[model samples]
Target: MNFKGLFRHFTDMKHYFVVVLVVFAISFYLGWANSDRYSFFLEGQLQGLKSVSQSLSAKGNPQIWYFIFIFLNNAVKSVLIIFLGLFFGVLPLYMLVANGMILGYVLSLQTNESTLSVVLKGILPHGIIEIPVILIACAYGLKVGMLVWKMGGQLFLPVERRTARRELANVFRLSKTLIVAIVALLLLAAIIESTLTYWLVHL
Candidate 1:
C-alpha cells in the first residue's frame, strides 16, 4: 500500500467538505435543522428504556437500541462514502465533514445532565469505526476530486483519436477500481459497526 499516497489523498480531504459545511448551513436555515435532532432521534429509540428507571427515565431496550443506533451510524457513513466518491472534487469530503460539524454543534447544545451518557454509551462505541470509515472514503474522494480538477474533461478527449480510445479505457479502469474500493470500505465499516459496536456498548 502506498501509505504516502494514501496520506496525501486523505489530507486533501479537508478541501472536499466545503460541501458538507454548506449543507449544514442550508440545513440550519431549513426547518429540518435543530440542535435537538440528535436528542429527538435518540429519544424515539429509547421509549422502552424508560421502563428501567421510571423516575429518572431511561428509554428503550438497551440491546435493541444499541443495534439500531450502530446500524444507522454506519449506514449513513457508507452513504457518505459513496456520495463523496461519486461526486468527487471535495463534495464527498464536505458532506462527511459537515456531518462532523453537525454532531459537534448538536452535542454542544445539549443541556441535559445525561448528555455525556448519551454520547459515551450511544455514540462513541460505533463512532470509533464510523469516523475512520468517513475519513478513508474522504481520502479516496480527495484523490479523485484532485484528478478531476487537474484533468477536468480531458479524460474524455485524447491527444488524437487513437489516444481517445486509450484514455477512455484508462478512465474505465480508474472508475471501476475506485468504486469497488469505496464500497468495500463502506461495507466493512457497516459490519464492524453492527457487530462490534453493539456488543461493546451493550456489554
Candidate 2:
C-alpha cells in the first residue's frame, strides 16, 4: 500500500491506536510488577521463544527462513485477531494483553540499559511496523464486533433488512483493507527483523 493510504487509514482510526496503546501499557505494567512472582512462567515462555529462534538459526541462512517463519506466524496471528473480533472483540483484546505482557516480561528480565538496548536494536527496527499492524488488525476486529452488535440490535427493528445489508457490506469492505494492510506490513516487518534487527542486535 502507498504511504498516503496507510496514513489516511491511521488518521481515520486514531481511537483504535489509543486503545492498543492503553492496553499495552496496562499489560506492560502488570508484567513488570509480577516478573519475579512469575519467574517460572517467564522461563517457560523464554524456552519456547528460544526453540523457535534456534530452529531458524539451524537453517542455512537464518534471514531467509526466519523471514518466512515469522511472516507466516504473524500473518496468521494478525488475521485471527481481525476475524476473531466477532466474538465481542474479546479475542483481539486477549491477544493484545498476552503479547504486551510477554514483551514486558521479556524486557523486564534484563537491566534497564539492556532493556533499552534490546528495544532499540532488536525490537524497534521491525516493531514500528509490526506493532501498528497488530493494532490495526485488532481495531478492525473490534469494528467487526461492533458491526455484529449493531446488526443484532437492528434485527429487532421493524424494517432493518436493507440497513443490515448495508452494514454488512461496509464491514466486508473495511475488512478487506485491514487484511491487505496487515499482510503487507507483516511481510516487511519480518524481513527487517530477520535481517536488520538481527544484525544490529548481534553487533
Candidate 3:
C-alpha cells in the first residue's frame, strides 16, 4: 500500500473530517445535557447493547467472541456508511449523531464512577483508535455524498461532468486504502476493548 499517498489523501479531506467532528461534538453535548429527557430512548439502546454483550459472553472464550463481534460490527458499519454516503450523506451524519449521543448518554449514566476513571479505563483504551477511524470513514462517506451531488448537478455539463467523474474515481481509490487501514485499526481496538478495557473496568 502507498502509505504516503494514503496519508496525503486523508489530509486532503481535513475539511470534511472537521465537519464530522463538529457535528459529533454538538450531538454529544446535546445528549449529555439532555440525558434526563432522552433517558428512555438512550437507555433502551444501552439495554440492547448489553443484551448483545451478554449473549456473546455466554459462549465460551468470551474475549475472542467479544473481539470478533466488536471488530465485525464496527468494520461492516464503517464500510457501509462510506458507500451509503451516496445517498446524499444523510446516513453517515445520522450515524455520527447516534453514536455521539450514545456515548454521551453512557458517560452521563456513570454517576457512581468518576467520569475520568471511566474514560481512562473503559473508553480511551480502544476509543482513541476506534473513534477516529469511524470519523475518517464518515468523512470519506461525506465526500462521496458531495461528489454524487455534484455529479447530479453537472449531468448536462460535459466539462464539469468529466471533472466530477475523475474526482469520484480518485475518492473511490483512496477509500479502498482507507477501508483497509480502518479494519486493521479496528481489529486492534477490539482486542484492547475486549481484554484490557474489560479487565480495567472490572477492577
Number of clashing residue pairs, candidate 1: 15
Those runs of model 3 whose alpha carbons end farther than 4 Å from true positions after fitting are: none
- Which regions of candidate 1 are displaced past 4 Å? 1-88, 114-116, 153-203
Candidate 1 lDDT by residue in tens digits, 1-203: 34444445444456545544455446434322444655464344345444433532244454445445545655565545544554545576565545555565545555654667757765675566556555555554555555555455565665563443453344334544544554565555556555665565556
Residue-level lDDT of model 3, residues 66-119, one tens digit each, is 898999999999999999999998898888888999999888888898999999
Give candidate 2's whole-model lDDT: 0.80
TM-score between model 1 and native:
0.46
lDDT, residue 93, candidate 2: 84
Tens-digit per-residue lDDT, 1-203, candidate 2: 24455556667567877887898889878777888877686678678879999998998988898889899999999998877977978888888887777788888877746778889997999999998788778877776677777778887777746375575565565666667878988999998998899899788
Off by over 4 Å in 2: 1-12, 37-45, 161-165
Give the whole-model CA lDDT for all candidates, comma-separated: 0.52, 0.80, 0.89
Clash count list over all predictions: 15, 0, 0
Each candidate: RMSD = 8.1, 2.9, 1.4
Worst 10 residues of 3 by lDDT: 156-165
Question: What's model 3's overall lDDT?
Answer: 0.89
Lowest lDDT block of 10, candidate 2: 1-10
